[model samples]
Target: MDEFEKSSIEGRVIELADSSRREVEQEANEAKAEQQRYIAELLKNSSKTPIVVSAVLTSDHQSIRPDVLQKYLDATILQASSFSQLCEQADLLNVKLIQHGMAENVSQSLDSRGILRLPVIKRHYPSLVYESQAISGELAVIDVISRLNILPIKRFTAKTGTNIGNGEGDGYLQFQLRNMFGGGEQLKLDITKGTKTHSSYLLDYGQPVTPWWMLNSMLFKNSRQFGNNNSIDMLIRGFRTSLRSGFQEAGAINHELFYEAEWRTSKLLSLHASDTLLFQAGDDIKSSLGHTLAVDRRNNPIAPTSGSFLKITNELALGKYWKSQVEFSQNNSWLKDDFIGSCCTFRSGYIANLNSSKKTVNTYDKFHNGGANDIRSFQIMGLGPKDLYDSIGGDAFISYGVSLFSRLPIKKWSHSNFRLHWFFNGGKLINHNNAPLKSVVTQLANQHSTSVGFGILLRHQVARFELNFTLPLTVHSGDAMRKGFQYGIGVSFL
Candidate 1:
C-alpha cells in the first residue's frame, strides 16, 4: 500500500512542473513576436525623403542659447512620423522651450501657387556661449565648404587717410572685397571716397575751438563690381597742394602694394598674414613715410624704424574658449637698427552659464632698441634727439590679469543692454638697468606709478558701439606726480 501511494505522488509533481515550464516559454515567445512587429512597422514606413526643419528663438528680454533651441528642432525632425508631422512637431517643441522671458517667432511663408517659400524662425536671445559656438561651428563648416569649392574668402580691410599739416582738407575712403568661385574665381569689390569741411566755436566764452576746420570725404565710388580673384591688390595715391602762412609746408607722393593669403585648419583656429610695401618721396615726408621703434621701459628702442615695416601674425584657438597669438616683424622703423622687436599676446574667455563669465590675459613685454630701424618718438616729436649708440636701453615687460563680466540690463533701455565687469590687472615694465638711487627713491616715494581702474560698459548692440570710461581708483604715489585725468571714448583696440 505505501509503494503505490509514493508513485502516484511523484507522477503528479512531474506533471505540475512540466505545465509551469510550458507557460513561461509561451509568454517569452509572445513578447519576442511583439517586439519584431514594432520594429518592422518602423522600417516599413521609413523613407529616404529629406527632412526640413525650421526654428524660431525668442526671449522675453532675456538671453538664451539659440543652438540649444536649434537642437530641439533637429531632434524633433529626426524622430518625426511624416513631413507634416515634422513641422507640427517643431511648433510643439517651441512651446515647451520657453524660459526666463524668452519667446520664439515661427511661421511658414507661402507663394501665390501654394508652394512653400522659406520657413521663418526668429528668436530673441542675448548672445550665449553655445550660440556663439554653434555660429562659429557653422561658419567653420561654411569655410570648409568654400575651400573645397575653391571660393574661400581671402582678406578684408578698411583704411582711412588724412592730410593733417597742409593739404586739400580731409579725404576718406572705405573699401571691402569678397572672393567667390565662378567659372573662374571672382572678386567682389566695394569702393568709396569723399571730402567735407566745417568749423565751430564754443559759445560759453565765444572761444574758437579751431582757427580753421576742413574735411574731404570719399563715398564708395562703385558697388557690385567684380574682378579676377587671383589679382593682387593695387593701390595708387597722389596729392599736390600748397599750404598757407602759419601752416607747415607739406607736399607728398605715396604708393602702396599689398598682398594677403589665408589658411584655416578648423573653425576655432585660423592664420592670416599679409605683406605691405610702401614708398613715398616728398618735401614733408613725415606724414607720407616714416618709422619708429617701440621703446622698452627704460626708453630704449625695442622697435626702431622710420621708413618700412615687415609684419607677420599668427592666431590660434586651442578650443572653443581659449585663444593665443604671436606676431613678428622686421625692418620696422620703430625697432632699433641693431635689435628686432617682437611681441606675443594670449587671451582666453569662457562662459560659466548664461550669467557668469571668466577670462585670462597675458602679454609679452616689448624689446627696445632691438630692430634694424631704430627711430625714437621723443626725438621725432622734438622732445630729445639721441643717436642709437647713445640711446641704447630697453627691456621687455609681462602682464597677466583676469576679468569677470556679467550682463545686467537697464529697465529704462531694455534693448540697449549693459555689462558689469570687474577686473584686476598687474604687470611690470622691466628696465634694462636697475634704477639709480635717486630714481629708486623717487619711484618708492611716488615717482613711478601702477594703475588700477574700474568702470561700466554701455553697449548698444544695434549700432555695434561701446562707450567705456574707467577711473583709476588705485595709483602708485609716483603716478600722482605725473598723472592727469585719463579719459577715452572706446576700448584699447579702437
Candidate 2:
C-alpha cells in the first residue's frame, strides 16, 4: 500500500466520516437530497470507474475543490494509485469532505430555520487527485439550494453620535432593522440630546456594577452653566424590538432566550432642580416587558482570560415601574498558563415603586453608587441615604465586588489587558421603610459599607479604566465621605 500509504488511508477515511457527522441541521431539500444520495451510491458499481481523489482544509479553515471536482464525480481521471480498493470503495459512499464557497462569498452554516442557504467557506482544499474526472456524478444541488433560501435582505438604519461631558453636551440618534418579515424580526430607533451639570440626580447614580459611560464621557469638559434650575437639560426617545431563539443546545453552555418590547419617552430638556420632586410634573410614558436569561461561559469578553458570566434581567412596566437584575461574573488563573488572575464580581438589584410605597424610584430607574465604578472613593451616589448632598435612591439593594488581578510587575506592561490589584467593595442601598430580610440583614451591618484599595486597571477595548485612591477605612460619621482621588469605571466583566 505505497502511494503515500494509499493517500494516508484515504485521508483518514474522510476524517472519520466527517467526524461522525450529525450536528443535525439540514434542509435545502435535505442538503440537496443528501448530496444526491451520497453521489448515487458512489457511482453505483463503478459508473465509468477510476476513483482516487483527495482534498483537505476544514478544521475552521474550510475550503476544497480539486479542480471543479468532476462536477460531482462519476469517475475517470487517473494518475497514481496504490489504491487500497479506492479506500474501500470511498467507505461505501458515505464520503463527505464538505466545504464549497459560492465563489468567495462566505458562510457554511448559520441559516437556522430560514432553510439552509449554505454556500461560503472554501479557501484551500485541493491537492491529491490521482485518478479523478469522468463525470455524471449527478448533482442537482437541491435546485441550487432552493434559490438560496429566498434571498431577501430587508433594510433600514440610521445612527448619530456626538457627546462631550463634564461641563456637558451630548447628542445621539439611532435606528435599525433586520429581517423583519422573514422571521428574524428586529427594529430599533432612538433619539437623544443631553446636558447636565449635576443638580442632584444622585450625581447621576453611580456604578451599580460598572458602566457609567466613561464617567458619562468622562465629564465632557465639565460644562455646567445653562440657566433656570442650573444646567441639566435632556430629551430622550426609544423603541426596541428583538427576537432570538435557541436554548439548551445540547450542553457546554450556550443558552439564549431574549424577547423584548420596549418604548420609552423621557423629556426634560427644560425643568431641573433634579426634576423638582420627580418629573417636576409633566411627560412620562413607559411600557415594557423584558426578559433575558443569559449564561455564557466566557473565555475572554475583552479581557476575562478565563470563564463565567451570568445574567438575569427582568423588567416589567405596565403602570409606572418594576425592576429586577442580577449579574454574576467570574475569572481565574493565578498562573495556569500564567496570565495572572483572580476576579469575581457580584451585582445585586432592586427597584420598586409600583405607584405608592408613596411614589418614587424613577430618576429614570434609580440605583446609585459612588463613582469610578461602584464605590471607589465615593461621590456618584455617594454611598446611599442622603437628601442634602442628594443620592436618595433606595427600595432595597445590595452590591458586591471582588478583585485580585495582578501582572504589571512591569515587563512592558506584562502582556496587556493591564492589571495590578487589591480590592474589596461591599454595598447596601436601602429605603425599605418596611424592612425585614432579618431587618435587612441587620440594617445590613449598619447599612453596610466597605472599601480597601490600591488600583490601576487601564485595559480598554471594551472598557475597564480605573484610578482609585480610596480610604474610607470603616467609618460611621454620617457616611458619604470620599476622602481622596476616585474615578473608576468598569464594564461587562459583567
Would you estimate the TM-scores of all the predictions? 0.25, 0.26
Stretches of candidate 2 above 4 Å error? Answer: 1-131, 134-290, 299-305, 308-312, 324-334, 337-339, 344-358, 361-383, 386-402, 405-422, 426-450, 453-494
Write down the TM-score for model 1.
0.25
lDDT of 2 by residue, 130-176 (tens): 46575322321111110111123334657788655223456766665
lDDT of 1 by residue, 71-117 (tens): 54454433453344444554554433321112333333211122222
The superposed Cα distance between candidate 1 and the true structure at residue 74, in angstroms, equals: 20
Which 10 successive residues of model 1 have the least lDDT summed?
A: 140-149
Off by over 4 Å in 1: 1-171, 177-395, 402-410, 420-422, 431-449, 460-494
Q: Candidates' lDDT values, in order?
A: 0.27, 0.49
